[model samples]
Target: MSYSTLSSRTVLVTGATSGIGQETARQLAERGATVLLHGRTAEEARAAADRLIATTDVEPRQLHTYSADFAHLDKVETLARQVAAEHPHLDVLVNNAGIAAPERHTVTADGNEVAFQVNFLAHYLLTCLLEPALTSDPGGRVVNVSSALHRTGSIQWSDPNRTRRYTRVAAYAQSQLALTVFAADQRVTAVSVHPGVCDTALLPLYAHKGISPAEGAANVVRLCDPAVEIVNGAYYDRATRVEPAQAATEDRTVKRLNKLADLLVSRSAA
Candidate 1:
């Protein structure tokens, strides 16, 4: 894509403290977009921005740092409000923040599985809260950094947190499945992507070795480009657009996931 194509565009990338999220922020900044770098903490966000400025031609003005702990729905709400108030005309939202499920069952203080809440629930709440700002412009869109493992997953509608039975891989895959299903929501122009098994903190969940985060990030950045026309709910494996798991593309699943997410976040469907 042309470097100038992203000029004046404002993109928010969550979990930008390291790995693919950080690299996505770096690449977007290099492409001349105003990048809002989000981290689990303020310090991490600032550090990511510092590293980007020091290593690349990105200037401080081209980066903004934001932080919120996704394990808490309240923090996610606060983050949405902050971003919307400061940058009311956001161009893209890259939901790249995620975590691997623990070997043992665990739940956040919000009473949900750790990985599910951090990976999907938080993004759901953030996206809904930012709908006004996202819809302010015609081409505004959301890119969900989902995973290939979603195909191995199924949502336990009755026990989303897997309170009855839980395994780390199953928990993580379920989160990714929910994220992919969420892209089908008609509330925003959105798509989901499996950026390949990149060498990141979550790599242990996939394999021992993998591609670089920068390589994985390029695939994500491509979808964020306004020059690239995309159909809402499209799913890509790396750069190739392919059909997602059958349930992910179903309208019933989309609505069902949205309803579940709304109840989990303790908010009405937006």
Candidate 2:
């Protein structure tokens, strides 16, 4: 991809402090796009932004820091409002902040499962809240940090919270699977990517797996390529090629997922 040609766009990347998110920010910055880095805390967000400025060709004015702990629904709302208020014309938003759970269950202040809260639900709510700013951009894009593990998952709407049956790994898979379906349902020029087991801190949560963060993020940079935007909603693996599975093609499932995600969004907003 020609980095110089993409310089005119602006991007907001969540979880920019580490792993694929961090490398994505770096690659985008190198390509001359203004990158707004999001971190769980203020200090980390600032540091991530600084790292981009210090190392890439990104303009200083284009680099920004947004700090929000996604586990808190209110914080996600606040972060959304802040972005729209400050940068009313957003070009792309990447929901990349995620956590893995290999054992046990945890709840957020809002009482939802932790992995689903940050992984699928928070991004869903935030994007819906920012629709105006997003769609306002001529050809906007939203990237959800999904996983290949989604192929082995199921969404029990009656027990979306996993209050009845839960396993740490399955919960994570469910979150990613839900996000993939959400992307299809919203038709919001979004796509879910596995990033193919990047070797990042998230690895320890699952006993360390996959390649390096840079390789895991190669698809992210490709998603930004003009060609990828032309074919939105297509799943891309590490090679930046679309490789959606059987479930990704089911309209009935997509409809069901849309209804489920809508219900969850309304409940959270209420």
Candidate 3:
């Protein structure tokens, strides 16, 4: 893809302190897009922004930082407002912030599973809140960083939080699956991508070999490319289009998950 297409465009990438998110931010910045780098805290975000400026030759104004704890739904809302308040428009929003807690089950302050909240709900809320800004641009895009594990997973509607039966891989897979379903159901232009089992920190405990973060990020950047015509609500494996699991294709489950997500966010705000 050419950098000229991204020039003057504004892009936001979550979990950009390191790994795939960081590389995506760098590449976008290098292409002359105004990149918003998000992290869990202000300090982390600032550090990431500074690193981007130091490493890349882009102007300081071309790279910005925003902080929000995705585990906390309220904070996600706050982050969305802040982005809207600061930027006049957003051309791309990359939901790359996700977690893979393979050790044990942990719930956030909102009483939702950490992986579920971080991997799916947080991005869902953020995207909804930013819909106005996203829709303002004719070529706007929302790229969700999902995983191939979603193919092997199913949503546990009875216990979406996994409170009764918690397992690391199960929760992680379910979260990815939910994200794919959510992307498929959105009215806005959105797509979910599997970053090819990269060597990111979110990888499973037993796995050691995979593609580099830059390689994984290339796939995401390709989806974000404005020059290419993308099929809205499509699922991709790297640059290739692939069918998601059966659950993701079902309109009923998508509606159900969307309603559940709305309830979760509303209850948290209440």
Which prediction has the highest TM-score against the true structure?
1
Sort the candidates on TM-score, descending order: 1, 3, 2
- Report the lDDT of model 3 for residue 127: 91
**lDDT (tens digit, per residue) of candidate 1 on 5-33:** 58778999999999999999999999899
lDDT for 26 (candidate 2): 84
lDDT for predicted candidate 2 compared with the true structure: 0.78
- Candidate 1 local distance difference test against the native: 0.93
**Worst ten-residue run, lDDT, model 2?**
261-270
Model 1 root-mean-square deviation:
1.1
Candidate 2 collision pairs: none
Best by lDDT: 1
| Per-model root-mean-square deviation over C-alphas | 1.1, 2.4, 2.0
Off by over 4 Å in 1: 1-4, 136-138
> Which is better, 2 or 3, measured by lDDT?
3
On residues 69-163, what C-alpha lDDT tens digit does candidate 2 reach at each position?
A: 98898898899999999888777888888989547778778878888889888898888888788754555888777888888778777887888
| TM-scores for every predicted model | 0.98, 0.90, 0.95
Better of 1 and 2 by lDDT: 1
